[model samples]
Target: MLKTLSAYIGEYKKVSIKTPIYIIVEVLMEILIPFVTASIIDKGIQAGDMSKVLMYGGLMLVLAFISLFAGIQAGKYSALASTGFACNLREGIYSNIQNFAFSNIDKYSTAGLITRMTTDVTNVQNAYQMILRIAVRAPLMMICSMVMCFIINPTLSFIFLGALILLGFVLFFIIYKVTPIFTEGFAKYDDLNASVQENVTGIRVVKAFVREDHENKKFSKAAGNLYKIFVKAESWLAFNNPIMMFVIYGSIIALSWFAAHFITDGTMTTGNLTSMFCYVMSMMMSLMMLSMIFVMVSMSVASARRIAEVLNEKADITNPENPVMEVPDGRIDFNHVNFTYKKDSDKDALEDIDIHINAGETIGIIGGTGCGKSSFVNLISRLYDVKDGSVCVGGIDVRDYDLETLRNEVSVVLQKNVLFSGTILDNLRWGDENASEEDCIEACRQACADEFIERMPDKYNTWIEQGGSNVSGGQRQRLCIARALLKHPKVLILDDSTSAVDTATDAKIKKAFATKIPGTTKIIVSQRISSIQDADRILVLENGCVSGFDTHENLVENNKVYREIYEVQTQGGGDFDEAGE
Candidate 1:
C-alpha cells in the first residue's frame, strides 16, 4: 500500500516539500498541547502564580492558533495534491485506453470500461487523499504522544503501552476481516454499474418490451446487496471507535488508581500527579487518531491495488523501435494473411487469403455474419496483428509505419458509430482537429448530412449530446462519414456503416464517395447486395473463408450464397441501381 502511495505521489507535480512541513508543524502543535495543560496544573495552580498561568496558557493559545493555521494549510496542500493526482491519473488512463488496439478493447465490454473510468478512479482518488493527509499525520502523532508520556511517568506510560498494543491487536483483526469485504464491494459495484449502464442505453428497447418492472427488480437486487455490504462494513468500522474510546478511558481510570499510592507515600508530588493525568488525556486523543487512520488506510490499500492493475498493463500493440515512416501510396497488398483472435488456437479468423488493391480503386467485401468481414479490414489498419502474413499499406508493411501516421492515413467508420459530447462541427473535427469551417461543411455536403444539419437550430454549431443520443441513427452515420471525409485519408473503410441510412440515402452517399473522393482507396463491407452491387470488385465470404472474388455480376452468377442474397433483397421491392455506362 505504501509503495502504491509513493508511486501516486510521484505522478503529481503539486506534491512539494511544503506538504511535509505543514504535517510536522501540525504534529508538533499536537505534542505541545498536553504539556501546556500539565504546566497550567503543576506550576500555576500549585504555586498560586496567576502570571505564570497566563504566560503558559498564552503560549498554548499561540500554539493552538498556529495548529489551526497549519491545519488549513495542510488541507490546501492535500486538496491540491489529490486533485492534480486524480486528473493525471484520469488522463494517463484515458491515453492508455485511447491507444489500446481495437482487439484489446473488444476483450473488455464497453460497460465494464465505463465502470473502470468513473467508479474505479473515484476509489483511487479517495485513497490518494487519505494517504497524503491522515496516513502521514496519525502515526506520527501516536509515536510523539507515547514518547511524551514516557518522559512524564515511565510506570504509567508502561500501562499506556500495553493498552495501545491491545488496541493494535483489535485493529489488525478488524482490518484483516474487512479487506476481503471491501474487495467484494468493488466487484458488486462493477456489476451494478454495468447493469445500470446497459439498461439506460437500451431503455428504448426495454420500454418497447415493457421490461421496466423486471429491470427495476433486477436493479433493486443489486442495489440491495450493495446496501447490505455497505451497512456491514460501516457497522464494523463504527464499532471500533466506541471500543477504542472505552479502552482509553479505562486505561486512565486504572492509571489513576495506581498513582494514588505514590502520591500518598510522598514519592510523587501533586504537580507530578497532575502531569500524569495530562499524559493520560494525550494518549486517548492519539489513540483516537490511530483508530481512524487504521480504518482508512485499510480501505485505501484495496483501492490502490485495483488502480495498479490498470496502470501496469502492457500494451500488445506498440510501434517497433526505428520504425519506418512510410507515406501511403494507396497500394495495399495482403500476402497469405492468416489471423486468429485466440493465442493458441488452430482455427484462423482469416485463412491463407491473398489479395492486392491498387491505388484509386473500390473494393467490396460481402460475407455472412461472423465471416471475418470486419476482422479483414481491421488488420489493414493494424488494429490486430496477422500471424501468417503481412498487410502492406502504401507498398510497405502496415507495422513499418508509425501508428499515428498510418491511422491518420486510414479512416474507418465502424459498424457502431460513435459521436462525442460536443457540437456537430466539433465532433466532425475529430477527423482533422485543425479542420476549417468550410472543410466541415464540404464533408457534410458530400456525406449527405448537410440537409438535416442545416435544419438544426444551430446548424454546424448544434450541440450533440454524448453518444449522439440526440441525433437519429441515420444522422449519426452521416456525421461519422463526414468526420472521415474531413480527414482526406488515403484509404477509407465503410464497414456496414450505411445500415442505418435508407437505400436512397445510401445511393447518394455512394455517388458522393465516387465523385467527391476521387483518389481515395475504398473498402465497402456490407451484408446488403444493393450497398456493394456497383463496386469494381466484390469478395464473397462463407464461414470465414473467401468463397470467390470478382465483379457483382460474376459473383451472383457463380456464388450460390451471393445469388440467393441478391434474389431475396432485390425481390423484396428494394430497387437496386446497378446501371453501368
Candidate 2:
C-alpha cells in the first residue's frame, strides 16, 4: 500500500525532499541555542566578562533567526507537496474509474468511490504533511538534545532515558488498541456517505411518500454507528496526552533534584544544571511530537488501504493490440452470445443470443422487464464483454476494434435518460463536439424536441440544471434523443427512451427517424406494441431467449408470445409487459 500510494508523489518529490532538509537545518539551530545560553551564564556572567556575554548572546540571536526561517520554508514546502499529492490521487482514481468496464464498476458502490476520493484522500494528505515535517524534526531533535545533555552531566541525563522507555511502551500500547477501532470506523464512513447520497438524490420521492421520518431514522443509524466507533477509539487515545505529560514532569523533577546535589558537591556547575533543564524540555517535547505523529499515522492507515484499492484496480476491458480504427457500416451480429453480470452466477443475463441485423434496417425489440433488452444492446458497444461467443459491429469483432471507434458508431440512449448541467446546445454537443448551432437544431428537430425547446424562454441556449431536473420527464427523454441523433451513428439503439413521451409524440419521433435518417439502423425497445409495429422486423424475447424474430404480421399469426402481446394491445387491454410485472 505504501509503495502504491508513494507513486502518486510524482512531481512533488523535489518539494518533499526540500521540506526535510529545511527541518534538519531547523533542528540543528534549535539544538545549539541551549549550549550558547550555558556559555553565556557560566563563562560570562559568573566570571564577570561582559564581552563573552555579548558574543554568545549575539550568536544565539543569529541562530534563532535562522531557525525561524527554516521553519517557514519547511511549512511552505510541506503544504505544496501534500496538496499536490492529494490532487494527483483524486485525478488518478477518477481516470481509472472512467476506464472501468461495467463489470468492474459493479464491484464497488457509488458512495464507496466518492468516500475514497474525498475523505480518504484528505486523511492521507494530512498524514503525509505530518510525516514530511514532524516525523523528521522529532527524532533528530531528541537524539541531538540527548547527546548535549550527556556531555554536560551524564548522571542526570539517564532520567530522560528512563522516561523515554516508559513513554515508548505506553504510546505503543495506545496505538495498537486504537488502530483496529479506527479501521472499522472508516468502513462505516461508506455507509454514512451512501445514506446521504441516496437521500439527496431521491429527495423528491422521499417527500412524496411522506417518509421523512423514516429517512431520518435511517441516516441517524448510520451516523450513530460511526460516532460510536470513533468515541471508542478516542477513549483509548485519551491516555496519550496525560501519560506523556506525567513522564515529562517526572523527568524534570528527577533531573533537578540530582543536579542540585551534584552542583553542591562541585561535580556540576550552575551553568551545566541550567543547560540540562533545557535539554530535558527539548527531549520531552520531541517525544510528545513523536506520539502525535504515530497517532496520525494510525488513523490514516485505513484510509491509505482504501485509496490503494482503487489505484491498483486493473481495467477488465481493453482494446486489442492491433485494433480496427474505423466502423464501416451499421450491420450488427450477435453470434451465440452468452453473458452474465457475475462470472459464477447460475443464470446468465443473456443466453445463447443469436441475432443478426442488417445495415439501415429498422428493428424493434419487445421484452419484459428482465428479458435482457438493455444487456443485449450493451454488448454491441463492449460496455461489458460477452462471456461466450462474439458480438460483431461493421463485420469486425467489437473487441478487435478500438473501443472509442466502436462506441462512437453505435450510439445508445439507455432506458434511464440523463442530461448534464449545461445549456441545451451544450448537452447536444456531447454527441458531436464540433457540431455548430445549425447542426444542433437539426438533431433536435429529428428527435421531435424542437417543438418544446422553441416554447422554452431561452430555446437551445437555456441552462439545464444538473440531471435535467428542471425539465419534465418527457422533455428530458427528447433532449437525450436529440443528443444521440447528433452523433449521426451508424446504429441507433433506444432502450425504452420514448416511454416518457406520449404515444403520438413517440410515433412522430419514429416517423422523423424514417424520413430524416433512413440509412441509419434503428433499434427500438418498448413496452407499447404501436411504437414498433411498423418496423421492418420485430424481435420478441422471453426468459433470456429470442422467442420470435420476424415481421410484425408473421409474429402475430404464428408466435405465441408475440401473438398474445399483439392481442392484448390491439384489444385495448392495457400495455404488454412480458415479465408479467
Candidate 3:
C-alpha cells in the first residue's frame, strides 16, 4: 500500500524531503536553548559576572529566533507537499476509474467511490502532513532532550525513563482499542454517503411519493450508526490526555524531590536541576505529540487502504498489443456467445447466442422483460466481453481490435442516455469533438431534434441542465440520438432510445436512417411492433435464447413469442410501453 501510494507523490518529493530537514534543524536549535540558559544561571548569575549573563542571554534569544524561522519554513513545506499529494492522489484515482471496464466498476458502489475520493483522501492528507512534521520533530526532540537530561543528572533521569515507559503502555492500549472501531466507522461513512446521494438524486421522486419522513428516518439511522461508533472510539482515546498529564506531573515531582537531596549534597548544582526541569518538559511534550500522531495515523490507515484499492485496481478490459486498428465494416458475428455480468454467477445474461448480421442490413430486436435485449447489443461494442466464444466485428474478434477504434465504429445510444452540464452544442460535440457547427445541425435534423433546437430561445446555444433535466424526456432522447448520429459510425445500436418520442417522430427517425445513411447497419431494440414490422429482419429473444430471426411477416405466422406480441399491440390487448421490461 505504501509503495502504491508513494507513486502519486511526484514533483512534491522535493518539498517532502525539505520539510523533514527543516524540522530536524528546528528540533536541534530548540534543544540548545536550555543548555545556554543553564550557563547564564550557574556561571554568570551565581558568579556575579554581568558580561557572561548578557552574552549567553543574547545568544539564547538569537537561537530562539532561528528555531522559529526553521519551524515556519517546515510548516510551509509540509503544507505544499501534503496539498500537492492530495491533488495528485485525486487525479490518479479519477483517471484510473475512467479506464475501468464495466465489470470492474460493478465491484464498487458509487457512494463507496465517492467516499474514497473525498473523506478518505482528506484523512490521508492530514496524516501525511503530521508524519512529515510532528512525527519527525517529536522523536528527535525526545531523544536529544533525554540525552541532555542524562548528562545533567543521571540519578534523576531515571524518573523520565520510567514515565516514558508508563506513557508508552497507556498510549499503546488506547491506539489498539480505537483502531478497529475507527476502521469500522469509516465504512459506515460509505453507507451514510450512499444514503445522501440517493436521496438528493431522487429527491423529486421521494417528495412525489410523500416519503420525506421515511427518508429522514433512514438517513438518521445511518448517521446514528456512525455517531455511535465514533463515540465508542473517542471514549477509549479520552484516557490518553489524563494518563499523560498524570505521568508528566508525577515524574516532575519525583525528579524535584530526588534532585533537591543531590543539590544539598553538592552532587548536583541548582543550574543543572533547572536544566533537567526544562528537559523533562521537552521529552514529555514530545511523547504527547507522538500520541497525537498515533491517533491520526490510526484514523488514516483505513483511508489509506481504501485509496490503495482504487489505485491498484487493474482495468478488466484493455486493448491488446498489435491490435487491429480499424473495423472494416459493421458486419457483426456472434458465435456461441455467452456472457454473465458476474464471473461466479450461475445465470448468463446472454447465452449460446449465434447470429450473423450483414453490413447495411437493418435488424430489429424485440424481446420481453429480462430477454437480454440490451445485453445482446452491448456485446457488439465490447462493453462487456463474452464469457465464452467469440464476438467478431468485421471478421476480427473484438479482443483483437483496438478498443477505441472498435467503440468509435460501434456507436450506442443506451436506454438511459445521459447529457452533461453544458450548452446543447457542447453536449452534441461529445459525439465528435471537432465536428463543425453545420455538421452538428445536420445530425440534429436527421434525429428530428432540430425542430426543438430552433424553437428554444437560445437554439443550439441554450444551456442544458445536468442530466438534461431542463428538457422533456422526448427532447433528451432526440438530443442523444443526434449526438450519436454525429459519430457517423459503421454500426448504430439504439437500445430503446426512442421510447419517449411519439410514434410520428420515431417513424421519422427510422425514415432518416433508411434514406440518409443507407449503408450503415442499424440495430433497433424497441418494444413497439410497428417500429420493427418493416425491418429487413426481426430477432425474437426469449429466456436467453433466440426464438426466431426472420422477416416480420414470417415471424407473425411462425414464431409464437413474436406472434403474441404483435397481436397484443395490434389487437388493443396492450401497447409498446406496457410490454417493456
Candidate 4:
C-alpha cells in the first residue's frame, strides 16, 4: 500500500510542496468553521444585538467563501497533479511494453496486456485523483474534529472515539473480505476479454464451422463466472455502507443526547451543546467518506499490483550496456546454435544448427508447422536469445548490439499483420516516420496495394479500421509489406507474409521487391514451395533442426523432405500464372 502511494505521489515532484500547502489551508478552514458556528450560537445569538449578530454572521459567511475559494484552487491543482501523473505512468508502461522482447509479449496474452493498459491504468488514475481530495482531507477532518470535540466536552468526545474505533474495524473487515473477491473478478475479466477478442477476430472460422452457439456458450460461461465474482465483491462492498451509516448515526444520536443532558445540567451551554451536535455530524460524514476511500483503495490496490506486475517485468532479452551493434548489410550466421523455450529446461527448440548467409542473398525456410522456422527468424532479430550458442549478425553476437540498431537493420512482416487505426499514409509512415507521399505510393506499388488503395475516395488518406478489419486479409498483408518496404532495412523477412494472397499476386509482389528493393537481403518462410522456389537458397527444418539447406533445384535433387513438400504444393504442377491480358 505504501509502495502504491509512493508510486502515485512520485509522479508530481514539481507540485508536491504547493499541493500540501493548499491542503493545509483547506484543513484549517474546515477546523475553523465549526468553532465560528459555536461562537455565533453562544455569544451573538444569545445577546440578540443585530449589529453584533450581523458581524459574526457576516464573518462566518466570509470564512465560508474563503474555504470555497481555497477548495477550488486545491481542486485545480489536484486535477493537474493526477492528470499529469496518470499520463506519465501510462506512457512509461507503454514504452516498456514496446521494448519488451518477443518472449515477454508471448508470456502475457494480448487480452492480458490490453487489460493492463486500459482497466489497470484507469484504476491507478482513480486512486491518484482520490488521494488528494478525500484521502488527505478525511484524515484531517477526523483528527481536527476529535481534537475540537475533546476541547468542547471531554465526556462526549470519548463516545465519539469509541464509535470511530468500531467504524474503523468494520471497514477493515470489509476490505479483508472484498480484496480477494475483486482479484478473482479481474482475472475472470481477462478470461472474458480473451474469449470475446478471439471470437471476434476469428469470427470467420467460427461461422464457417457453425460454432456460433459453441462460442456463445464459451463466452457465456466466462461471463457467468465473472458475474459471480463481481457480485461477491460488490456484495461485501455494499454491506459496509449501510452498516457504516447505522453505526455512525447511532453514535451521533448517543453523542447528541449526552450533550443535551449536559446542557440541562448547566455544565455545558446550549451553544456548546449545539456545537457538539454539529461536530458529531461533521465527524460522521467524514468517517463515511473514509469508509468509501478504504473500499476503493482496496479495490484499486489489487488493480495496481496487476499493472505493476507488467511494468516491473524485466524481459528475457535486453541489450548489454557496451554491446556492438549488428551489421546493417546482413551477413547473418548461426554457429552451432542450440536454443530452448525454457531457461532451466532440457527441451530444445533448435539444436546443433550451423548456418551462414552473405549480404543481399535470399534464404528460404521450408518446414511443417511447429518446425521452429518462426523461432529461427525470431532468434535472428534477437527476439529471444539462443540458450546454448551464439546467433551473430556480421560475426558479432546479437546480444552485443543495441536493440534499436538491431531492429532497424532487420525488418519482419509477420504472417498475421495488424494495421493500426489511421490513414493509409499514416500506417506506411510507421516504418519511416518522415517518409513522403511519393515514397508511400512507391512502396504501395511495390507491395501491389496502390491499385485498391487509389480506388478508395480518400486515396492515401483513407482510414484503416482497427486490425485492418475493413480490408481483405490480402490487402492487409500488402499494406504491411508496403509499411515494411518503406523502412528499407538491410535484412527483410517475409514470415509467410503472402499466405493470404493468391500465388500469382504473391509472385508479382516478390518480383517487385527484386526489382525495386535491390541489394536488400530476404528471408522467406513459407509452407508453399512455389512461394520460395526462386530463392537463392532454401532451408528445410524438421523437429527444430535444420535438416537441409541449399538452392531450390538442388534441394529438389538432394533433400527428400524438400522434394516431398514441393510435390505436395504443386500436386500436378498447375500453373499459377494469370492468362495474358
Clashes of each: 0, 0, 0, 0
lDDT values, one for every candidate: 0.80, 0.92, 0.93, 0.82
Which candidate wins on lDDT? 3
Candidate rank order under TM-score? 3, 2, 1, 4
> What TM-score goes with each of the models?
0.92, 0.98, 0.98, 0.91
Q: Write the per-residue lDDT of candidate 4 for residues 68-115, one digit (tens) a residue.
A: 887887788878887777776677678889878887887888898888
Per-residue CA lDDT of model 1 for 188-224, tens digit only, reads: 7777887798899899899999999999999999899
In terms of lDDT, which candidate is stronger, 2 or 4? 2
Winner on TM-score (3 vs 4): 3
TM-score of 2: 0.98
Give the higher-lDDT candidate: 1 or 4: 4
In candidate 2, how many Å is residue 502 off?
0.5
Candidate 4 lDDT (Cα, 0 to 1)? 0.82
The window of 10 residues in a row where model 2 has the poorest summed lDDT is: 572-581
**Model 1, global lDDT:** 0.80
Give residue 487's error in model 4 in angstroms.
Answer: 2.6
* Residue-level error in angstroms, candidate 3, position 173: 1.8
Rate residue 68 of model 1 by lDDT. 88
